[model samples]
Target: MATKLLTFVIFLAGVLPAADAAIDIGKVLGEHREFSLFSSLLSSTGVARATNSREAVTVLAPNNTAVVAALRGVPRGADTRALLSDVLSLHVILEYIDADKLELLAEGRSGDGTRVTTLLQANGKAQGRYAGFVHISVGEEEYDRITFTSGAIGSPWNATFEKAIAQLPPSVSVLQVSGFIFPPGVIPPQPRARQTSMPPAPSPAPGPMAHPPRQPLLPAPAPAPPRPTPATPNLTNTPPPSGNVIPIPIPSVDGGMNATLPSAAGHRVASSWGVAGLLFGLVVCLIWSL
Candidate 1:
């Protein structure tokens, strides 16, 4: 019985180290000082605790500088915690991917890339077929260069894989990327490129036309008093003249003449008086001769 118990104790001791060999994400990240900020974020958001339950996962951990840059524009508040939680979850892919697997994928696909789902998808926050997925592809010029792209709306962001931070084959792998992988709606869409050209100067609004001053109303000059009609002379009451007298004309108001002239009877009377005078002269001359 003593020999059998010693053999069982040795077997138990042999099994304990293998159990303790599982990767601790927090410890893996904590070993690298450059990832200190990312590690703290993972702790604060409780993502580090949840990582152990997953069978396999690849953490694309951004360096301190990259994390700082990503947080610069994010506003602070209660929503920030939730936002950061979502963002950190997006960084975690639900599969084991290391440099070797990435090279194999790149070679197999000819740079077309492979899509991998993330923790965000597992949380059910991502709904569509491609939502909360990371795109892994090789650089066009350099076949060895691997790139990770986030499927952000309108503006997708890309991060180049710098190096493998830590790797435990077929279980967990933490990769150092050039920048943070921002999920759709995480970063504010760039304020639609500030209308730089200065909005076309608003067309000058047309102004009202100026009117001329009105003159005071005047009673039209009383029609000029009708010119007084000239009075007409009464010819019926005037008596006819007995001698050969000619009346001089007088200018009337209308620039015309009004008068009487000598007639044939006056001429005949003059002729008769001249003949009688001549006969008396002849008779007196004969008496003187006797």
Candidate 2:
């Protein structure tokens, strides 16, 4: 019995180290359907193999939706493969950070948050205080919320923690993030083209008539007759004829006799002396009769 126990113990010691030394990221991601595209990217970019050799590492895997969104407008070619490799490298961290460790770091850090180095630093693609670094922090208002922000200057890309995918402890920890965490100078996703119908063309305006209708004609108005003018009398000084003169009666005043005047002249002419003489004769006759 002592010989059999010694052989079993030796076998167990050899198997445990090999199991803990390497992790298959593709297998872990393949289990989840939502990470199918992400898993493919890791395989194609060779990020999965690179990650397996690392001692301790954390991966922020975006869902298929996020992968699709980030790939929008990106052309396919050798250059594209290199770009994707660099991007996936940035998503990997050199140290294992599980949900518990992330919460503890959040609680311990100030408002500036904690910075962690990524695989980019190991590959020598980037070097600096912020290059190949990502900032992880908890939301100020919502303590349960966590965010991953790009360390690149002036980069607006950020992703929120969705849920823990798998945790192998000291070896590997994969977490699902809301979207892609892009660094500076990386082109963002383009919007889908909308299918819209064109508006109908306006009807052509009516053209002027070729031949216009004629109007009916009416008779012209008659001219008015001329008015008659009166004749003016002649004003000449001429003597009257001798035989043609006719007498006209002139009435006297104050109960005296009426005197006779010559007609045929335009006007009557009784002298002043004749009028006085007639009045005087009447006075004499009146005295005699009394």
- lDDT of all predictions: 0.76, 0.77
What is the C-alpha lDDT profile of model 2 across 1-290, one tens digit per residue?
A: 99999999999998876555467888878888999999898889888888877888899999999888877756677877877787788899999998889877655556556878888768887645576788787765666788787776655547888889999888889999988776666555444565487789999999997887765597666788877787554345543455655654455677554654346341435465578889999999999999
TM of each candidate vs. truth? 0.56, 0.58
Residue 184 in candidate 1 has what lDDT? 60
lDDT for each residue of candidate 1 in 30-50, tens digit (9 for 90 to 100): 789999999998998877877
Best by lDDT: 2
Residue pairs with backbone overlap in model 2: none
- Cα error, residue 42 of model 1, in Å, equals 0.9
